[model samples]
Target: MNDQGEELLARVRAVLSDAGFDETATGAEGVHLIRHARGVMLGWLPEDLAQPRRRGPRRSRRPAPADLPGLRRAFGLAMAAALRAAGLTVETRGDEWLLVAFERAADAS
Candidate 1:
């Protein structure tokens, strides 16, 4: 991973944590979601899940699950909007439940 990727993951972790998600592990291929204080409502997509990957011949090169395109796009847009609403910029890569979001500083006028 590059520096930018590391930074992006950090930002995602921070945002999710603030939104009530717990940090369970720092592993590369783990998915995490937020649990509300009362546990009534779980965190929504994009922020709740990491990019979904299927087991492949080689663990390093797995394929993304099907049925993720639309969901990923919608989740990405929602996350982006949420980040923007918090005065941050978001960029996503990949499709539905597999999208990853990175927070960035808004452009200075």
Candidate 2:
């Protein structure tokens, strides 16, 4: 990536951080790997529960299976908002969730 790309990347990352998300991993060379820090609340109990969660478990805080979809959706929405705010273009390649941004030839100084 060029200097412009790196700078834009930093700005985008800052936006995500400011939006209550954290960079969890270094995904592909150009993609940002981010997730919500507190995670999406399922309005119910976490996994590792013995029953249907009347009061809930006073034990581990492992996320329930149902929470995965909500988490993924939250991440996607945040990413979309950040990209839109940045005026960045995202290309969906097959089944991969990826976001790529750059200065087009005409937009470059």
User: What is the TM-score (0 to 1) of candidate 1?
Assistant: 0.36
Instruction: Output the lDDT of residue 103, model 2.
Output: 42
lDDT of 2 by residue, 1-109 (tens): 5566556667666766776654543332223443222211111122323333447557445554454666555556556676667666654422325454454568556
CA lDDT for candidate 2: 0.47
For model 2, how many clashes? Answer: 0
Give candidate 1's error at residue 96 in angstroms: 6.6
Model 2 residue 32 CA deviation in Å = 4.8
TM-score for candidate 2, please give it: 0.48
Q: List the residue pairs that clash in candidate 2.
A: none
What are the runs in model 1 whose C-alpha is more than 4 Å off?
1-14, 18-24, 28-63, 94-109
**Candidate 2 C-alpha error for residue 106, in Å:** 2.3
Worst 10-residue lDDT window, candidate 1: 34-43
Q: What count of clashes does model 1 give?
A: 3
